[model samples]
Target: MFSLLSSTFGISRPLILKPQTWRIFSSTHVNHALPMDPERRKKLDERNERRRFRIAHDPEYQAKQDEDKKQRRLRYASDPQYREKLLEFGHIWNTRKSQDPEYVEACNASIRARQRSFDKLRVRLQAENPRYRLRKSLHQWCLKHDWVRETLPWKTHQPVLFASKVHKECKGCTRVKVREGVKLWWRKIGDRDESWLCHACHMPMDNHTAAMPYGYEDVTTMEGIINRKQELERTAKG
Candidate 1:
């Protein structure tokens, strides 16, 4: 790897062969010579429990931990190498955990319980909050459209409709599609403007078109609007 980097970046071999570089590299290859004695393991567990208690009860320590976590997340996002390494480690860890059926079952049960609680809370919020009700209704209306539904990808983690592919942001509201489904409309043929329109922005235009608000001699329906959008998308792609 060093030789490849040297060849690619034109770094001198002597620089990589320095004593300081060797010392740093060797330091990372520490051997676990100490055996896990029962007493030592018990002491370590007690120390970890104390640390956890301190983190939970101490405001200063908690704040420091939160800051440290934020910094780690920022670094993970900005540093591709670090992100890749972390992902690789996580994949390996998950793979090992998944090999145990009992562990997998426990994880699945916990996830299901959390999802049920979240769903109940969401339903209650929708019933109580007028704003939430309107937002959720608008979002549901958008999902009834074929084009918008197709854009969402399936996920193994969450079992919900339109639960995946949240990267697209709506042009009108700047909200992601995953929060509420979005409609990507192509205004005309041969023009490819990836303008994402969330339900809140799309509904008014849809209503206006259906109402023939401009007094034009044209009739429009929800199906007609969806069909037109799909046709325009195909034309733009072609």
Candidate 2:
């Protein structure tokens, strides 16, 4: 009967008649069946503390940790969702830091330094390149001659003519010029050929000091132009 009872209760020991022995065996079996032991838990805690201490005290370990962190950040940044989260976090961090006057002044100082560096570089480049000086002189001449300013259309109060739209930079002349608000000035190369020139450079060749605007007194028609040219020739001869 005792053997039958032990088998039924799943007791590992041989039949013992004492109740105290049965209790001791059952308690010991329960302790052994537990998932974690006290000694194992203590050993795990110690290992984790040592790792933390090494990460703090050892330069090599700290560098490894930083590299690992950088790699993780790069990986996360490649993900669009994580990138948005990182941007939001950075904006919030910067916004909080911007409240400090020292931080604001430091940022302004750095910006001023960068601006000064850029200015020095530009001056150095301009001094090194003769073409830059020539271009600057040409630009100044254009401005001085009023070649790059707005003009009213002949006999009309419509929208002002923008010089940049009507004329281009004339490389042949010391100054740019406009003609009848037109961009091209063509000269006869032969009986059947013509060559295009900018109005500014063409003015001297055509014996004109200034460009004639469109709709100027009877110069609008072919006959008017011929008569005007004849009158100018007669005046020049006289």
Candidate 3:
């Protein structure tokens, strides 16, 4: 009858009694089969408990997990491509407002106000101190030189101011060399006048002797230096 039923249903007879099914049938037929080893089961349960405890109590693992989440959040927030895409979307959304005249005017006005305030402060500071004024003048001279170079391509001859004294072993030998000379003439460049050195440093082989005025004392303190510099500036101006 089973063979007839299998042939009618087109089913393989061997598949109906597969190995797993046969094992179940045999176990059912034989009662009181040996149960799983209690020791092995207990060992498996202990291993699972240890795994759970390790996951719950490991401080380093918890810290690493937290660090990963923090880095992920930072990457998402600071990704340039993501920000650019967002900006592109915003541009599309505010196509008309992007070109609005009122917004541009407001931005320009804020910038101009900031520039004016900065200029006023700069002027006041330069007027308050001689050193500040000298520095401002030097900066203006450099800017004017740059502007002149830009406007006149062939004007390669530039008037450079140099210091009068040269140092032999000083760290600023190059600077001293560049600054050697006296200010024969003064001219305003941008915001201040340029000054030239009154004397030039003698070359190492040259017979030039260091000249110090009789009874001259060296200034050491910052205040003394400032006073001396002011006196020098006054003399130069005269």
Most accurate candidate by TM-score: 2
RMSD of each: 18.0, 29.5, 29.6
Error of 1 at 153 (Å): 40
lDDT of 3 by residue, 3-92 (tens): 232222221212123222322111112111111244644554465466457657998866766687577557647897754554454344
* Clashes in predicted model 1: 0
Score each candidate by Cα lDDT: 0.44, 0.43, 0.38
Q: Comparing 2 and 3 by lDDT, which wins?
A: 2
Q: Higher-TM-score candidate among 1 and 2?
A: 2
Question: Model 1: per-residue lDDT, tens digit, 1-238?
Answer: 4333222222221112323233212212211111124465455446556767988899998898778777877896799997666555444444554466764555466558778999999888768964444445435534565544344221111111343444445445655443454233212223365444444454343332321212221323455545656665687799
For model 2, what is the error of residue 143's alpha carbon versus the real structure, in angstroms, after optimal superposition?
A: 5.9
Q: Which runs in model 2 stand beyond 4 Å of their true positions?
A: 1-74, 77-92, 141-238
Q: Where does candidate 1 have its weakest 10-residue lDDT segment?
A: 26-35
Candidate 1 residue 59 Cα shift, in angstroms, is: 4.5
**Highest-scoring model, lDDT:** 1
